[model samples]
Target: MTFSIVGRCEETGQLGIAISSSSIAVGARCPWVRAGVGVVATQNVTLPALGPQILDLMERAKLGASAALDRALCASEWSEYRQVTVVDAQGRTAFLSGKQALGTYHAVAGKQCVAAGNMLAGTHVIEAMIPAFENAPGHLADRLLAAVHAAIGAGGEAGPVHSAALKIAGEQSWPLVDLRVDWSDDDPIAKLDGLWQAYRPQMQDYVARALNPTAAPRYGVPGDE
Candidate 1:
């Protein structure tokens, strides 16, 4: 049982995905981001490799989100069981919910976001997410998390989801923000939100350290001193 939101920040050109599921470690197989390329979320009998495959088409093959998703699914033998969403660097979006995607699957693509859910409480789950993200104020990550929160608030999976993840990519090859609650029955989204708040201030600092050591701020650790 899974639901996700993949989006782009039209203002910043940032792309990322936020997702949660009743399964354990959903983060490991779902959300995927490529700094300047796009974001993808493959769930409901997921093929994790599909994330990179679609991203490859968009990044190197220069395809838009729809065409990229087309090329990736064409090669999949189990496409019927998968639910996927894609958001390109240009903020274009596309998604699919296979005939065999399992219970109560629904999806929608709007402005700069695409949301999908399977084995959900109801259609209202995805419906609630889009407007929250669109109206929420702040960074893409905040909006993304808010979207997931809205989904969960609307009614999450058919059962309890023990894991959640948030991933955002910027100018670097790595994610500017990557947080996960691999297995927590309590509330993974809330935990992820706390992690984001703690890491938010250091995000730019870490990026600066990677790009320019001389100008980067000191770490205050033994070797750093």
Candidate 2:
């Protein structure tokens, strides 16, 4: 049903996730990340609860990503139907693909990243994502976008992807940058890329405001004037 990558940027310390799926609203269903906590992408049968549950456990103590994922998998009723990838605050990464997952579900875990997907054309789909992220130059968000693009080129989901998203968090739980293409007639991944490009300027502006509200007026708002 979906393919996703969850990771942290070694350069920026920004935690994020990028996902695409044949299902509608894949962004809402597949990807979740909490900056300074961890990232989770729950696919296949898709246990949405595992997203926050894993993060909560990691927050309670400084557990490694694998330990947290193991604990969560043990507690879930649908463990056999779920595929999850997690990267904790310390940059440790982990992934689990259930035996009962749909066709070709797989995962790759690296020191700084994890890529996972189900219903893919082949195992190389997830493998391509890792090097794409590593070779991509720029911020965490850009690298995530590259990973998604790589997966798409590697044959993507077994079916057409309808939705995609990218999420990044910081000191606050609220996403610093969250962009989604819920449904698209065009290439959803490309649509997501365009939206991300358009949104980056606005996102930067918003972060600038948050850092220095007094400078808001300079950007042409009424208060700054």
> lDDT of each model, Cα atoms only?
0.93, 0.86
Best by lDDT: 1
TM values, all candidates? 0.97, 0.93
**Residue pairs whose backbone atoms clash in candidate 2:** 217-224
Superposed by TM-score, candidate 1 places the C-alpha of residue 89 at a distance from the truth, in angstroms, of 0.7
Across 69-131, the per-residue lDDT of candidate 1 in tens digits comes to 999999989899999999999999999999998899899998899999999999999999999
Any runs in candidate 2 off by more than 4 Å, and if so which? 217-225
**Stretches of model 1 off by over 4 angstroms after superposition:** none
RMSD of each: 1.0, 1.8
lDDT of 2 by residue, 1-225 (tens): 798888887766789998988888988877888878988898888889999889888988667888989998999897888899999888998888888999988899865899999999999999999999988998788898899899989888888988999999876657998889999867998988898888877886687677798664366767566
TM-score of 1: 0.97
